[model samples]
Target: MSKQDGSNRLVSGPEVDDSTATILHVDLDAFFASASLLARPDLIGRPVVIGHDSSRSVVTAATYEARKYGVHSAMPMSRALRLCPNAVILEPDFSLYSRLSKQVMAILDDTSPEVERLGIDEAFVGIGGLRRLSGGANRIGAELRARIRRETGLVASVGAASTKYVAKLASSRAKPDGLLVVPADAVIDFLHPQPVSALWGVGPKQQERLARYGLHTIADVAHTSQERLSAWFGEATGRHLAALAWGRDPRTVEEREHEKSFGHSHTFSRDITDRSEQEGELLRLATGVGRRLRDAGVQARTVTLTVRFHDFRTITRSRTLPEATDVTRVIVEAAWSMLEQLGEMPPVRLLGVRASAVQDASDHGLLWDDTETWGSAERAMDAVHDRFGAATVVPASMLRRERKRDDTGPSGGD
Candidate 1:
């Protein structure tokens, strides 16, 4: 993993090596709020919270001012308002954000041919090819930030490092609007001092457990033996953490034509109490995900269902299939089963379905039963929807409801 070998020598720069710092993680500054406030120049430098204040709206993004008062993304709006009442709230405009995201991505694409988009607001660009033209990786990163600000009128924080994992953390440490570069040799030093939560897979619960074991920092995990980590977190996660703690990530950036996970979510205007309605919505989302998976020519081995209650408490459950599939019956069946495990539900505020562990359709082999019936049926449905319209075909249960809705529509004269 050393960057220097004969002709491939790492040129040492300030806090980074120009030759080794090929991977860069670029993240937009307070993406949603910043993009929306572009039209409202007066709102700059104020505490801004983005997302609706409806029954179950969660905070999508918050400005630095809002963040000071404990407001953060995924926090309930009610909680955020309690924390910072003076914060200016802006309803999210996804279309505007999407446009801005594309503009930023276009800049990155021009900067580096190998760009891996992580989300709408973040991407990792491999800058190895730009060495000669851009002087070095450090200059390429600086220019990237300068160009984005010059072209888009938005600030972007960038992190330059040897590995994607460290690069992502470096970018996060340079929040709001800043840049940080970690050299190949200093990757361990860069990772060790950070909080345990800084590790890739450590969540709130895992953090609490690690703290209980007196493992509060990445250095703690690094010092701890692999056997101990395995005993604490089980085999796979233990080994994963052990490797990461030493600043080891073998993954490389690749252009993804599609995301590893694709799904849809809907927040209800009113909380739904009816079990039938909840199941119906879950079915709809699952079916939608299945269609997208098949359309993209990918089979998903896992289905995850997310349900948020009226009080903003959320529960997510996932089911891994024995065989990957792009069939609606398999997806809906898995989602519904997982949803059932949440136990007696309260008034549901939102529902979501996601499909992950994706593989190309050509690589997926169908069992005899699925091939003969469900898969064929779904393919036919896909053909129908493609030729006619999305609403032309739906689940048998939703048909009657659609008819009822049409009947309730206003007459042509009225």
Candidate 2:
């Protein structure tokens, strides 16, 4: 990789999104795999897998060549090996990955303070206020990529957009060390033709749900009635998805103060097909999530339920409550309600629970004693769990999976 690879030069390409973009989503090109290749340059363009060669070890990273053979991050190492039998399986070096991540982060820090890191590899950097001082967004993005190469021997791809959501899409479109600029007025033109699955919140299950309504494309979502979407995806999420379909994201790029959301999901060793069994798993997850929220001294306004079927199709639903609470009973009941929304259960692969829109737990005026009493009892249980172990205190109707996982686990917090 060099400064003169033409990635630093502006070219009229189809993948380019020429919106009045000031948000930069810069991601290192295969951070772990690329860093691994630095010492083994001979494997630069080869199928390299960065993970231990063990039965349960998962691929932490795989180079693009390995990806061509369908290997990817989080894939079981055994599967990756079977897919790319001749792949160079390298064990990960966390010390080296951390060092490079810090260097890359330092480079980002030099660019802007308003950088919201999504992971070690990618972040959303707001360059709107720095337009005058730093020759516009795309130029800054291109220069940043070049600077990373010159200083850290790394290549980066950047997506510049008016909002962080679109910016991320732009960056993915410009992969392997390239830049794509999605201008403001061009947002709709750039987004509408894309699949509805391209939207941030729409996953496999949601995709199938939307597909049932003939909403396959972003344009279809844009044209669909907000009321209809609300009826299907709940009021808040329905409107949110509609707005995204029209490229109407309004989120800002700011330094995070604390974690926004926390979640837990578990894949069953064997698929469970019974509805009652799935309910038991979801209830267990809700208890875990509620415990986490209370332990963090926070209350969550929204709860989400995720169900993955044997075929790998996932279904997720989110509900925002009128009031935020960290009570296990409330969370469990809400989660169960969401499961009921699925109509009937299919053979299940995984179940998960997540809480979001978190805020510090505070005593609002005129609060009831029951809420306070419940908090005290839960805190007592937390102490018991901490002293004895997570298995010491649990919901009376706990599943075997939950009870078995409690040993030596953290008292709470995801």
Candidate 3:
């Protein structure tokens, strides 16, 4: 490909042609809720909510039927139940969901080499080369949806467009399992009538602010003067929003590296105040993060601890490790140390552990080095955990910590 100019503008030359780029955005329909229904077929056609089983717990995913009752992911589970009294509440099954996500990702990989995963349920696949294999973008989208359904027993919505932003918006319009294509000439037609919220990063506050200025739709934003918009929303956001309104995204689909951060968090059934109990929860979170890192062939150089109090106040503390490692004991110890340093303990509504600043296994030193030795031990332990089950091996410290925490009482403070 020829390089663009200094302004990042496409350079015109004898070799340059006005060819269209094909991008396909794939979104799994009601991912967590759908996966839950797949595991238990009886839940099909019913309103389902997947989240924690606590009054203060937030919903992670909800079926379309539940969404009709105003239940949505991130909403409090109690409010969701109040909205849809008959909705089936289910706990988030991260392990099962992660496994199913791997299967779906593998299927995408089978279709194209340039696949950019947005999350567990969404991805963008560059199909410039797929025309030879699957006929064209439209055909490839159809085949992809059909394949996902046939193999995984799930439905996916797809949108084909020249730009990623338009492709993503098209997918949203084609929800509950459908595919729509917005050709280069039809991008404006497909996007103009949509609400401002449809644009990426336009959150509740931005939408409300824009609405007051009579900018209710993408078309309105597109038609607004840049100078006026900048005065209202500031220069950077104004230009960014305007570009999105015009469907001018220049992003290309490319494979992303393994995640740089891996973490897991839990919302308690009740607010926890005990330090020992908090440590037990930290150990659990550490184990989850460690398993993920090992599975991805990565080691973390830093560990972070996050705490959210009952009032929704959140704080995070991180520490750099002397050497990169993925051992559960080491990660948990690091997290516990940060937690202890926080000083003022409050009733914690949520606890999380994260491993960040990840590096490849090869980055570890010689075989005799401490990091290399730890890496090997972790690999062996992971093998045992995979073959038998997660509970096959437990860190000795975690076991002792849990026992001590449990004896202190449910809140751990007494």
Candidate 4:
């Protein structure tokens, strides 16, 4: 946390040797909006907001220009419009964004095998073993930025440091497409004067509590005894904070781990009790989960459906499949069956679909000879869909509902 003027630069840890500290954090700039702008060059340099256009919708991403007018992702569209009336709001094209994210991840894969994808727009690549291959972290970061720009037409901010926290902070500091590096020797000098909020685990509530103890800055927290900090933050959080204050993190960049489950849920603008409508919503949720599983090259053996009643009480039910699958039809059927077990008419506020007991895609097997043949056919269809687009092919039921929805105009209640 090197202080310059009013800001603090992220510092490295003592365990990091000055000559060997090689960690990199990569963050795409205004990812969704930027990718949208790339597809539509006319929108470049303009204030772009990617999200639902409905008044009740929340923003998913806002360009830097939009940020100037106080527009930001996760903000209500109604408020964003009030803040920036002229801003161009676009519906989120998740399929396109997902495709582009795969492309970006592929680029990072070429750079380093030890890459941990944090989200669609960011990842950490360990270059500790690549010093001989790329000279140093600085050169590696520079090349990565250049490659991304040249290949994807997107700007990326990068931070190089010894620890994950420091690297992440450095990347945040190097926002709007920039790069920064923190050497090991400067860790304490760089971190001491910064606010405690600079530490990863220090959320607003924790910050307020620390402030009560006159521990506002990293220096203050660093000087405070670990026992005292633990008493305030509890054992785990306290220990974590103290270690971070000293610029200590032992996490490593590794392959993206397969999740135990894949799921998606939606909160309705208003609760409803129509069984047909609820079934339709469940199908959509199932489709979302299945798509994600296929995209990640994984399959789930158990399908779980969760129903949140209008009163907010939630119940979850799951069923194990005879065989793991990434097929949308298989998942949707399983979810529909689970929904049937919930009995009649209960107004629902939220519906969710979860696919758990995951396994590698290669682990999929056929239940019968005919099912094996269908599995090959399904794989072919998945390949075609992946190569073209999700909407290129879909279940007939989905197609009919989509057409009906389009005909009825946008879902008005948001």
List lDDT for all candidates, in order: 0.75, 0.73, 0.75, 0.75
Ranking under TM-score, best-scoring first?
3, 4, 1, 2
lDDT of 2 by residue, 1-414 (tens): 111122323322544543367799887877778887887998887889877666545666777777778787767778989988999988554435545666777788889888886755677888877878886776788889999899888788888888888888777667666788878888898789888977988877999998998899999999988999999889998999989998888899977523467566656656788777777877777766676677556788898988888899998999997778887767777888988888866788778888889887774431444766776787788778657766677766673543222101111100
The TM-scores, one per candidate, come to 0.67, 0.60, 0.85, 0.85
In model 1, where do residues sit more than 4 Å from their true spots? 1-16, 260-264, 272-348, 351-414
Evaluate residue 260 in candidate 2 and report its C-alpha lDDT on the 0 to 100 scale: 66
Model 3 lDDT, full chain set: 0.75
| Reference-based lDDT, residue 378, model 3 | 70
**Poorest 10 consecutive residues of model 3 by lDDT?**
405-414
Clashes of each: 0, 8, 3, 3
- Candidate 4 Cα misplacement greater than 4 A, ranges: 1-18, 257-260, 309-315, 368-389, 400-414
Error of 3 at 200 (Å): 1.9
Worst 10 residues of 4 by lDDT: 405-414
Candidate 1 lDDT, tens digit per residue, 290-340? 776775668888988888899999988888998888888888888878877
Model 3, span 13-51: residue lDDT tens: 223121354898898878777877887898888888877
Tens digits of lDDT, candidate 4, 1-414? 111111232323334443545889998877777877876899787878777666646777788778778776667788989988989977666556666777778999999888997766788998888898676776777789899999888888888889988888888777667777788877788788778988997777888989999999999989888999889879998888889899999988877756568776766666778888778877777766777777778888999988888888999999999999887778888999988887885798778888999999887566745655654666676677778866776656664443111001111000
**Reference-based lDDT, residue 410, model 1:** 7
Full-model lDDT, candidate 2: 0.73
